[model samples]
Target chain A: MIVATSGLTKRFGRVTAVRDVTLEVPRGVRFGLLGPNGSGKTTLVRMLLGLVHATSGSIEVLGEPMPRRARVVLPRVGALVEGPAAWGHLSGRANLRLLDAAGPGRSRHRRKRVDAVLEQVGLGGIDRRPVRAYSLGMRQRLGIAAALLREPELLLLDEPTNGLDPRGIQEMRALLTSLNEAGTTVVLSSHLLTEVEALCTHVGVMDAGRLALDSELAALRTPTGRVLVRTPEPDAVVGLLDGQVVDRRGDTVTVRGVEPATLNARLVAGGVRVTGLSEERRTLEQVVLELTGSGTDRVDRSPHGRRPEGPR
Target chain B: MIGVELRLMLRRRRVWLCWVLLCTLPTLVAILLATTRLAPPPGRGGAFLSAVTSNGQIFPAAALALVIPIFLPITVAIVAGDTVAGEASAGTLRYLLVRPVGRVRLLLAKLISVAAFVLLAVLFVTLVSYVVGVAAFGFGPDASLGGTGAIPSLSGVELTPVDVVARTATTVGYLALCMLALGAVGLFFSTLTDSPLAATLGVLAFVVASAALQPLDAASAIEPYLPTSHWLAWIDLFRDPILWTNVRGGALVQLGYVVVAFGAAWANFSTKDVTT
Candidate 1:
């Protein structure tokens, strides 16, 4: 794993920001940290970056224990924590050069690297513009460019698409996808499910300072071999159904592990009024709602894809 | 890197303004004194006024002494207070710390950069004073600021012109070191807050308080150790056989401050959570 945390926890006064979050992100994959506002995502990311001291437990980045060894591990890991913090007085190129000079290792080809990263992030022509004049999207791109200055093997971005328009978000998605494709491990946090759904290969859901769910994106999206049916008199329809996932929510009844036609026929035979039938693809967003809606006190996942089989 | 910090320091318009202001003050005073027949009053400005009329060569030394009470220290204070807090307020300190370099190195680089600024500010003040002083009044071998009462002296030191110039250089160097302690105070406050103005005012407040307490007989016991207490003690350097007592004491006290303040700054910064 490129990043691993075991029983990690953080608390501010009486509030716990993260609780027993044993997360692991394998190398060479795009991992998305999904959470609602105030959920432990930023706190977790800060702890991993050594900006916040963890209350208990352990964290290791690139196989090195953090933050005891952050100085050694962090240089190899690139990050844009929270929002883009650009110096208003300096041009984008000057900002990158100064930040690079302050980096842990000597950058031998800084001029070339600065130009290349600027071009890579699509800010080449605007390198000379003072950061204060740059648009919000432009500043965010510069922040990403700064993170990529070292060509780090792992990148951690917190809400990297913030203040970005749709076109800018697409560009950011493309940049992160390409970085991951080229063997860079990425873990980005966002409260927007669509952003994560469109980019990530894996997803971790946090809710009110707890890890509500952790699973492969593919698994999270896969059907739990279930179908949902909305019908009146669900309790009476349950006796007519052979499927075990006969859950009644409000006036609707969902029957899992049974063909929709078979379940529909049975409900009809029992003189039950069936109004709805739909396949449950169980996208990660749905899983998020299911998990956080249940509570912020425990971890949960889709039953069909709870554990990824075989080698990671 | 220290070079980058230094560049950033030199790039600010306020820095240039401070230096430019320092350079022109002595020039204005020298020009005004040389072109006029009005002698300054008998007590405070008398020594510099009397000496500057005939030999303006003493203008730089006298200007330095005049400004030492406030101007030069204020310039240093502004720069020093801005060191860490300036970057913090700008939201740049977090990015710098996230880089591979440690906080200790960053703090050291900041202190060094400010120290260099103090050196440059003092140099500009004195150099400009010398040029303007020599222009307004003729340059020549100078009499001592000793027994003649051009300035009061603790000892009657008969000195050659070359020795006088050398002693002036030593006095300037010692004053620069004392400013380091003042700057260190600014640096420490800088790490505690993000407002550059707050830090600058903090150092100025220290200077004002220290000076305010200096004349109090009741506080005299505690006053001598204040950073500003022995600032003018360099006057004794001009005495016959050069009185070293107060000069040595002043520099040592400043050194003690530098050690304590810098040590505290480093300790606080290294473990500081970079929330900004």
Candidate 2:
């Protein structure tokens, strides 16, 4: 594992920011931490970097016990937390140079690495401009460049696409994919389900400071082999199929446990004309909502004999 | 890294502005004293050097005293206040912390930079004043200290221009110690607060409170212990019969404050969870 946390915990006064979060990030994998706002993603990342002390539990990054020996470990790790925080008065190149000076790179190697990272992040042309003048997307890229300066083995990025436009997001995804392909493990926190789905190999869903689910993207998106049918008569088909009703709109019925062939045959045999029939594969977003219990509330319970689990 | 920090300092326009003001203040004062005809006492030339150099000691020290209450604290505030919180605000704190450098070394680098600025400011004040004072008043030996109390009076020592410059340099060294204590205090407050304004104000408030407490004659026994009280002890060098005891005591007190203030700053900065 490139990064591992066992029973990792953090608290601010009386409020626990992260509670018993246990996760393992394999090397060269793009892992996504999916959560809503204030769901402890930032806190967990801080603990892993030793930026904040963990209240309890253990964190190991690159095989080194966190925080206690992070000084020895951090050189191999890179991170961008929250937003880009560079000196507004200094140029982007100067900002990188200052951070680079503090890293383990030699003087000649420092300049070369800074130049390479700047070019890699598409910031080569604007390195001379003061950071205050850079746009939000540009700033974010500069931040990534700073993080990549040392070619760290593990990169922990928090909301790397927070304010990016579509093109910027695409660029970031490409950059991350390339980094991962080159054998760098990446742990990215984002609320954008599409981004996570498109980029992450594994995902961890967090809700209210606790891990709701953790697994590979493929497993989380395992095919349900069910199709949703929208018919004018949901009540008529209820008795005709052996599937459970997941949701019901004015004329749409989302059914589970029934294959598309069986559902189509049953609906036609019952003299019901299917207006809309489409296969539904579990999206990471849907899986997240289901695991976190948001999907349970909107699910229809009448005539299905399935009771929603009580709140945890 | 400190070398990089120094480059950052040099590139800042504010530092240049500070340099201008520092160089100009003493020269202006020297010109004003020379152009204005103050009635001379018994020994004319000796009286002139005494008055000007005495003023040199107190005036520059006073300038440093005032500058520190406002500018030095702000300088320290600008750098130290931004150390962690500013980085946090900029979203670079984590980036920097994740580098190989230890937090202790980073903090030490910043502290050293602030110390360099304080020393530079002190040296500027001393050199500028000495150069302008010597140019305005004729270069002569300090008068022998035959008259005033245990405070040795410089009445007959035919000190040349070089001797006067050397004496001024010595006084500046003493004054540097005092300003360094103030700088360290400013750094301590800066480390404690996130807002630069708050840190600057807090250090000033402490200085003001200490100064207010220093004048209570009833508290004379404790007055010497306060950092502000010994600020003027550099004047002992100008006295007819120099009082080494007061100077020595003042130096010790200043040193003690520097150690304590820096120690507190180091402890707080190293341990605080930097969340911005």
Candidate 3:
């Protein structure tokens, strides 16, 4: 695991931002932290990077316990915590120079590295422009350039596309995807579900300062393969299905391990008029709503019913 | 790391503007004093004119005295105040902390950057003063500048130009240390909030309040510890037999403030949560 947090918690005064949340990110995986506003996504990212101290729990990054080992571990990790915070007065290249100089990489080809990263982030020829003049997207890109300075093993970005345009988000998404493919462990927090869906291999959903859902995107997106059959004669529909049929509703029945064609044939043979039949496939959005609750505004009961069981 | 930080500090337009202003003050003062006689009515510029006319080499020393009270302090205050809180306000502190750089190292870099700024400001001021002072008045054979109206302790003593230069260097050095103390205070306030303006005003307000309150009898006991209490102690260096009492005490006091203020700043900043 690139990162492992067990029962991590953070509290500000009476408010607990992250509570008893445990998560693990495997090596070279694009891990996405998805949550609504104030759901402790940023707070969790901060704790992992050792920017904010956890109230309780252990955080191990790259097998080193942090923040006690933060100074040594940070050199191998790059993060853009809140946003792209660069010196407004300095040019993009100049700001990165300061960061690279202070970075632990200490590569002698500093200028070459900076130039390469700037170009990598699409900030090539315009690196001389002062950060104050750059658009928000450009500043965000430059921040990523700084994060990419060391070619770190792990990248922790908090809402990297927070204020970005569509094209900027696309570029950032593609860049992060490529980085992860190249063996860098990427952990990003974002509210945009599509962004997470497009970029992440694994996801952890935070609800009210707790990890409400943790699973692979493929697993979350997996189709149930069960077919839904609706009819007026509920008692007759049970005999029409060969597999164990369960009532999906008063008139509908759900059958497992039976194809839609087989069920339709059986229903026709049984002389039951099938009004409607469809496969059961739930989108990640539905799963999120179901796990978090229809109204996450109030502290509702822990509806861990749908939280998938088994090891990730 | 420090080299890069100092380079960034030197590249800022604001820092350049301050340098221009500091250089201009001594240049204008030297020209106005050198070209014209020192026979102005004795209210505001009288003491400086007397000191300069008595010995032109004393122009640099006198000029520092005239401006150290407000101009130099404000300059140093702005730099120190901008160092920490400015990054926080601009949202850059979070980025800096995520690198290999430790919080202590980052704060130390800021301290060095501001210290470099203080050094440059003092050196530039003194350099401009010296060039102008020499051009306006010859460099050699300056009479003893001590025990005049400002001191009246060791008058009529002749001194070579070397001693004058040495004393001026010491004076500048002392003023720089004093400014470092002031910078440390500004740095402390900078760590408290994210607004650089608030930090700057906070520093200025504290110094102004200290000076403003030093006059009351009730505040007399705390006067010695004030940042500006021994500001003019460099003047005593002009005495033939230098008075080390106030100068040493002032240096010690400034050092004490430096230690305490920087300790407080590091303590607060190291553990600070970079919300911005």
Candidate 4:
């Protein structure tokens, strides 16, 4: 494993941000951490980078215990957290140079590496422009360029696609894919389930300061072919069918643990008039929502139960 | 890296304006005094240098004094205040921290860059004052005492114009060191606070409070040791009989301040979590 957390916990005053979360990310794997706002994704990333102190438990990065000698270990890791930050007055290239001067690369290699990373991030020719003039997406790209300048073995990106348009997002996805193909381990935290599903080989879902689930993407997405059928006679179909009703809304029934053919056959045999029968292959988004106990209908329930479905 | 930092500091129009105002204030006072008339045997020229030196050394030195508590310290505070906090505010500190560089090295670089600004601002003020003084008054070496009210005739010294400029430069150097102590304090406060305004005002408050406390008879013994008290020691340079005792004390106090402030700044910065 390239990154592993065992019983990791963090608290702030009266609130817990992360609690007893255990996760293992393998080398050269693109791992995704999925959660909503305030779900402790940012807090966990900060702890992993040694920026925030872990309240309890241990974190090992690249097989070395974190924070004990983070200075030595961090050099091999690159990251883009929150947003891009550089001196507004300085040109983008100058900002890169300043960081390059302090990075692990030698002075002789600095310029070449900076140029290459800038190109890799699709920011090659505009290095002379002042950062103040750069757009939000451009600034984000510049930040990714800075992170890649050292050719680090591990890359940790938090919302790296933020501010990117559809095309920019595609380019960034391609860049990350290429980087991963080059054997670099990647750990990215994002709320974009589609993006994570496209890029990551493994996934971890977080909820209420705990790891709800962590598994390989393939295993977590085990091909459970299921479908939902909407009809006026759900009870009649249920009586005639061997399929399980995973969910029911009025007369509509969401049936699972059966193939589409078997489900359609049962519904028809029961003399039920089906208004809709759509096959539902589990999307990473649904799996994430289910694992985190944040299903579309269930997520609105308050912890105190004063209101079953309070305002989100 | 320092060059990049300096460029960013100078790029702000406000920094340039502050630099100009600091450098020209003494000269402006000298010109005003030179154009005006004065009483009896002393005449306008005598009164001008006297007023200019007193006001120059005091107000400009007070201005120079203000550098620690007011300008340079605030500038240092603005720069150092932003070092981590600004980056945090902008969401960049985390990006920088995750780089291969050690936290200590990053902070040391920032401190050195801020220190360079302190030195440059002090030098700018001194250089402009010297040019303006020579232009307003003829290039002559004259000395006057601040509190004693004694004036030394320039005729006896027989010093050349070059020697006068050299002496003024030395005086400015000493004053710069004294003010740098305050800059260090500002830098320390900058590390402690996330808001630039808070860090800048915090140093100003320290200066104002220290100066206010200096006049109390009850606190007389400790007042001389305060940073504000030593601010006027630069006037001792103009005294007919130079006081090395006060100069030494000022230098030592300034040194002690620099050590403590910088030590505190470094300690706080290195351990601080860069989580905005």
- Which has the greatest DockQ? 3
Query: What digit string (tens of lDDT, one per residue) describes model 1 on residues A183-266?
Result: 899999998899999999899999777787878898877776788878766777777775575577886676777887887787
User: A1-312 in candidate 3: lDDT tens per residue?
Assistant: 999999999988777888999999999999998887778888898888888888899999999999999888888998888788888888898888888887566559889989999888888888466789989888888888988987899999888897789988888888888888899999998877888888898999988788999889988876688888888887788765545675457877887888889878988888998899988886777777766633234444347856432111
| Tens digit of per-residue lDDT, candidate 4, span A102-185 | 555468877787789988989888847789899999999998898787788999999999999999999999999999999999
Ranking by DockQ: 3, 2, 1, 4
Candidate 1 error regions (>4 Å): A13-15, A222-278, A293-312, B46-49, B140-161
List where candidate 4 sits over 4 angstroms from the true fold: A224-279, A293-312, B1-14, B37-80, B141-166
lDDT of 1 at B268: 84
Per residue, candidate 1 scores C-alpha lDDT tens digits across B85-111 of 888887777677666667888889988
The global Cα lDDT (0 to 1) of model 2 is 0.73
Give the chain B TM-score achieved by candidate 1: 0.91
Which ten contiguous residues of candidate 4 chain B have the minimum total lDDT?
B148-157
- Collision pairs in model 3: B147-B152, B147-B153
Pairs of residues at least 3 apart in sequence or in different chains that clash in candidate 4: none
Each candidate's lDDT (Cα)?
A: 0.81, 0.73, 0.81, 0.72
Give lDDT tens digits, candidate 4, residues B1-276: 455445556676656776776666555556665677331243332222443442232223323533444555445545555555555566656766777556666666666666666677777876666556545543322433323322232232233334444544655776667666776777778778667667777777887788899999988988877887876676555544455688788889988888888898889877776667
Q: A67, model 1: CA deviation in Å?
A: 1.8
Clashing residue pairs, backbone N/CA/C < 3 A, model 1 = A104-B100, B156-B240, B157-B240
Models 1 onward score TM values of 0.84, 0.83, 0.86, 0.83
lDDT of each residue in A48-67, candidate 2, tens digit only = 88888888999989989988
Error of model 4, residue B145, in angstroms: 25
